[model samples]
Target: MSSSFERYQKRRLISSYFSVVLSVFLVLFLLGLLGLFVINSKKLSDDFKEQIPMSVYFKDQANDSILKAFGEQLQKSAFVKTDTFVSKETAASKHKDIIGEDFMQFLGFNPLQNSYDIHLKADYVEGDSIKKIERKFKENRMISDIVYDKHLVDLVNNNIKKITFYILIITGFLALIAVLLINSSMRLSIYSNRFIIKTMQMVGATKSFIRKPFIMRSIKLGVIGAVLAIVAIIGVLVYIDSQLPNLGVLDDKLMIGSVLLGVLALGVLISWFSTFFATQKFLNLRTDDLY
Candidate 1:
């Protein structure tokens, strides 16, 4: 009977440890997902900003040689990511294809002017920055007009700001919840061994000596949990990439390493702190109060 009871207790302890590990894994996995989303959001925003196109039209009298030199200069500008010079003939051909008829034939002349289709760097796509770029470009004698959808630029900037604000709020709230849930799991696991803690204290063992084993156990569990969470997060990223190949979620290795390291550190810290406090609580209690 004694051996059977001992076996049951050992199994129960193992079960309790497993429960704690599983709980920690789930919480950290959630936090990891949020971190992934936050990191990817910045990249996605920049990609969108860089896709907004603008055109710099040249004066009708500007010759091909002058336009080619201007194009080379534009390419060297810090603000420009890419620029393509569209000659008058090419522009007319594109318009003709789009309209399904030769507008040049109907009008008896090609009226399209030579222009450079410019895509600005993401940082310079905002309203004020674009205005500065426009002013600088218009200073050139060969350039006639700089045209872009100013309203669209403003709208994209405004919407991205709103999205960023909401993401920050959501991230903060989710992080708080993750910490609370992990701490609670650790506390409950420690609570089950309260009597053992009290017994160790009553036997004249130093508090640090008594707490050492439990702290070490918690740390081991924390590492296991963090490793499991990281595996789960990688699986999720893989699934997302499969479904949305263009997202390129797994392309940023540095961010992924940072998030994984952060999750591991958080798990160990939370587990150590929670276990320390919970063990201390029972150690300070009177023998009768343990009931």
Candidate 2:
């Protein structure tokens, strides 16, 4: 009968410990997932910005060799990602296809000018950087005018900034909630051992002595939970990569490593602080409060 009761008590202790670990793992996992999204959002924004093209039309008198050499020079520029040279003939043909008839034939001559559609690097796609690039390009005598949708540029920049700000706010809020939840879990787990804590104090065990074991145990649980969360995050990334091979965001090893390290540190730090405070509460409690 005595051994059966001991076994039952041991089972109950294990169950409580498992519950605390599970709570930490789930919270950290959710936080890590959001971190992934936040990191990738910047990459997606840059990709969209890089797609905005600047069209450069040359003067009608500009010869083919002069334009070809100029296009090669533009391709070598630091700001240029790619430059697509469109001859008068190609533009007219494409315009004809779009309008469902040969407008050039009706007009008796091709009105289209030779041009290059240049996609700038994301860093140079901003308003000031684009202005600088335009000034530099217009200095070339062969170039007549540089054109791009100024409204679209402004819209993309403004919208991305707003989106990033909101996501940051949401992430910070969720992080605070995660901390509160983990702290509560730790406190409840300690609460179950209130009587044992009191008894240790009554036996003349120093506060530090009593706390050392509990702190170590909690830290061990925290490490286990963090490791479990990291593993789960990796599995999720693998599944996402398999389904969407084009999502190159997972290739950012440094960002992923930073997030994982943060989770591990948070788990350990929160656990230690939560356990220390919870144990301190019971240690200072009067015997009457133990009831």
Candidate 3:
């Protein structure tokens, strides 16, 4: 009867420890996912910024030769990524599609002017650089005007900055909370085994000797938990990709691997430090406090 009771108690303790470890891992994994989003959002914002259009309207008298020369010059500009020429005919065709065939027919001759659709590099989308580019475009004899939605560009940049700031603040707060929670859970787990620690200390065990096994155990637990969390995260990513095909494009396999490795390293590091501190605290506690 006594042996059976001891076995049951041991099993319960092991179960509790495992549960706490699992909880710590889940919390860390969630934090990792949040970190991933914060990193990738900036990338997505930059990608969109690179695609913003900058339209250069040509003079009515500008012939294809002059327009082509202007395009070549524009291509050589530091800000330009690529420039595409949209002739009057192409412009008319687009307008006809938009306003219907009869509406275009009423305007006997094509009234649309030729233009160059320019895509700038992401870094040059700022107000100062765009203004500089505009000035350069106006210097060209064949170019009449440069048109772009400045308001939309400003709005996008402002929103991205605001979002980045908020995400950084939130990430910092969440990380602090996660660390505290994990530390508390680890302390409790160690506290449950305080008597065993005390017994070893009483038998002439040095502090390092007492700390070694606990550290090793914590590391093992952390590794197991991290692996489980990574598996779960991968499953979640796979499901999301299935539901939203576009999400698959955002899936950087190398980045995902790095995140997984980082999570594992974090788990091991946090667990080791938490266990060491918790064990040290108990080691310094008075015998009377044990009860």
Q: TM-score per candidate, in order?
A: 0.94, 0.92, 0.92
- What are the clashing pairs of model 2? none
Which digits, one per residue and each the tens of the lDDT, describe model 1 over residues 1-291? Answer: 999999998998888888889978988998899888888988898898899999999989899799988988987899999989898899999998898999877788998899999999999998889999999888889998888999989999999899889988988897787778767777877887888888888889999999999899999999999999999999999999999999999899898999999999988988898888888887888889878
- Better candidate by lDDT, 1 or 2: 2
Off by over 4 Å in 3: 102-104, 247-251
lDDT of 1: 0.89
- Give the number of the best model, judged by lDDT: 2
Per-residue lDDT value at 131 in model 1: 94
Give the candidates in order of lDDT, highest first.
Answer: 2, 1, 3
Residue pairs that clash (backbone atoms under 3 angstroms), model 3: none
Over 21-63, each residue of candidate 2 has an lDDT whose tens digit, in order, gives: 9988998999889899889888888889999989999999999
Model 1 vs truth, CA RMSD: 1.6
In angstroms, give how far residue 49 of model 2 lies from its true place: 0.6
- Against the correct fold, how does model 1 do in TM-score? 0.94
Of candidates 3 and 2, the better by TM-score: 3
- In order, candidate lDDTs are 0.89, 0.90, 0.83
